[model samples]
Target: MQLNAREETPVVSVWMITYNHEKFIRQSIESVLMQKTNFPIELVIGEDCSTDGTRKIIEELEQKYPQVIKPVYHKSNVGAARNAYEFCLPKLKGKYVACLEGDDYWMDPFKLQKQVDFLEANPDYILSFHDCKVVDRDNKVLKEGRLAENFKKDLPQESIILGSLIPTNTVLFRNRVITCPKEIFSVTNNDTFLFALLGQHGKAKFSNDVQPSAYRVHDGGIWSSIDNLEKRKSGLNTYEQLYKVIDSKYKHLIKKALFTRRLMLIKQNKSVLDSIKYYINSYNYFYFGNGMYKTWLKSHYDLLKQLYRN
Candidate 1:
């Protein structure tokens, strides 16, 4: 059965999670409003109490665009993690969701339109994310392409199983992909964790054909933005936190981490395959990676033990 691109269009909730993003909120809001899709879009933004005029900005936009904008402004600053995960959960009422942070704006109006068209056509696939061009606070293009090369080939199921696949800003997840109840929203980037879990349950998809959105790499981004060192350091810290969250799968991650690190080394004209050969061989039931990770784990435990002893 051939699918008409527009007929089975899914309802996409444009989730704009904000904290202290007064400067970029306007562009972000405007971006959601600019979508050229046939499906309905619900803009659910949690205006975490911003010290700046961001809340007033949201209010002004809400006044101007009453129908599209649906905001739950916090009386007090509730922090980004909670404001986004907890406060924004109740507000979402769509078949699928497209997450764009308040600090970043979508460059293409057809971003949601194109993604829904692809997802509806491909029923087996769970989530779809487009490559983003890095942009700055002034909306200036910082880099012409992706932050780093992720999923060199078209996305594979095992890749989703093993690889790190949450580029949260550009991703769109179907309601079916997210099985967690309302309470799961409090789980960190619960949206992100759900998407990866979705891939585990079903097939994950990707589009390498075109760049459908502009992912702004401002200072306050979830991941490392090239412009800021402190935020980038925090980003790495956040990455490690997520790392420890997935610590049970530490063995598998040791393989994946080494694999990607080797891939990067291959790009850099250095020999990494030989260096990380022990970890890579662990996938063949060798557990060499486990041996290495255990050493590090033991060292960490021993350090903690010394603190306790003292």
Candidate 2:
């Protein structure tokens, strides 16, 4: 006798937040529409008063596929983080949430189905992500795939504090906890905070698929447009502030990551004197003292390679 096989119900929502993305919003939306899944899925888009024709396209798409596209058009720009937390995310009705920005798109038609299947089978895992390809403003493939080595299948919350291991567009997470705390709004890295929050409930999984989404790099990108020096400084300051708000046990890991970022910034500036100053400042902490000196010395070889590549 054959046992009965039951199908899972539709329980996924795709949230897209966009501003001035007329150039790429269509592709992003189409990618979600192209997804093949047995369960029902909704695409909730928040268009933040885009000065470009982004809103026009969104409206047209909504008309054509009113059943699938749920749009929120704002009169004034409330910013991405605020728009998502305050207006967009809370309205989602799915048991699970997948995110994509207007500028980035999923490459796999089964992207949502694959991630949803994973989470449904593994109840302990709060989130799942996959590798992505990096593309330049012109759509040239800068890198075939971003993940150089395979990450652990399941990563703990504290382990992810060092940096963002998962790309924003590639993540699919449970909607068990949707609201962001008021304090988190003060911090600049909302994705990190969101992922960290999910991690606390359970571990995050990296899908075996190496090609899922294409991460776009352009002048308008919030973080990508900043110079390396300023970006590193901003990163350090952000982590310091984040440490104050996060769980006490994760503070040590955050501090260590900040020191690593500081050293990288110092090296990138190509100033031996800056390195000397950093070394002096780090003397107060034994962990950062002599070890950093050796690390700095070893970094020069990689620096030369970067120079040649550029």
Candidate 3:
């Protein structure tokens, strides 16, 4: 039976999660509104009680595009994860949910059409995402392409668990991909954890045809609130916590990935003693064949250097 794309129902829902994004809310909303698709699409904005004028802008847009723009306005500032699991996820009425942060915008007008078509054509794939350009606060292109080189390749569930391979703003996933499990509430890196869960259900792909979206990297970002070192450390902890809740097969993969991340973080450290301390804590979760010996020696040398300096 040949499936007709035009005959497909309007079941694609775009979820926009925002908090105090007055600066970029308009552009984000406009981008969603600009999508050209044959099927009907609804935009659900999860406004997390913005102190800035972001809520006002959303209210105005909702009034103008009442049929297209549906917003869940919170009274207080709940964190992004809660706002998503509690407020946003429940309101989703579409068969597939596409996510775009309030600060990010789609570069291509056919973004939604392309992604929805892919999902309809490829039923095995649980999630379909594309490359995204990283931009700064001023909308200047900081990175012309995707953040990771491997992002363009077709990615499996394991790859998603090992690292963040999918660009958030460019993702269009099945509505059933997420269940809002309580265990993930504490995860600092929600995207990676959620992606892992989604991956378990089916495969994920980085669509080559879909137009790229613009992902803003700025100080105001939730992840940007902490430094790189802290974020990585927090991510490692999140992965460990996830290991307990996830299936056994994914447990080793998370630890192995965190082990590699710990190595990178260790190299970034200036003090040898600090590196040794980091490794000592890391030993509880990971083991690398001969690399472990080398790290041990380097850590000892650093400890010696600290002793000598004193």
Best by lDDT: 3
> Of 1 and 2, which scores higher on lDDT?
2
Candidate 2 lDDT over 1-310, as tens digits, reads: 0111232233788888999988889999999888888777888899999999999999998887777788988989999888888889887888899989999998898888888888999998888888888987667899877776756356776666656577889888999766777756776677776776666677788987635588999878897777767766666666666666667776667666666665566456656666545545433322454456676565555455555655
lDDT of 2 at 56: 97
Clashing pairs in 2: none
Residue lDDT tens for model 1, 19-128: 77888899888888877866566688998878888888899988876666789888898777677666776567778888888887777767777778888898777777
The lDDT for every candidate, in the order shown, is 0.61, 0.76, 0.79
Cα lDDT for residue 176, candidate 1: 56
Model 3 — which ten-residue stretch has the worst lDDT?
1-10
Tally clashes: model 3: 0
Task: List candidate 2 stretches off by more than 4 Å.
Answer: 1-10, 150-154, 259-310
Candidate 3 Cα deviation (angstroms), residue 113: 1.6
Off by over 4 Å in 1: 1-10, 147-153, 177-192, 209-212, 225-310
1 against 3, candidate with superior TM-score = 3
Where model 3 places Cα greater than 4 Å from the true spot, the runs are 1-10, 148-150, 270-274, 288-310
RMSD of each: 8.9, 6.3, 4.1
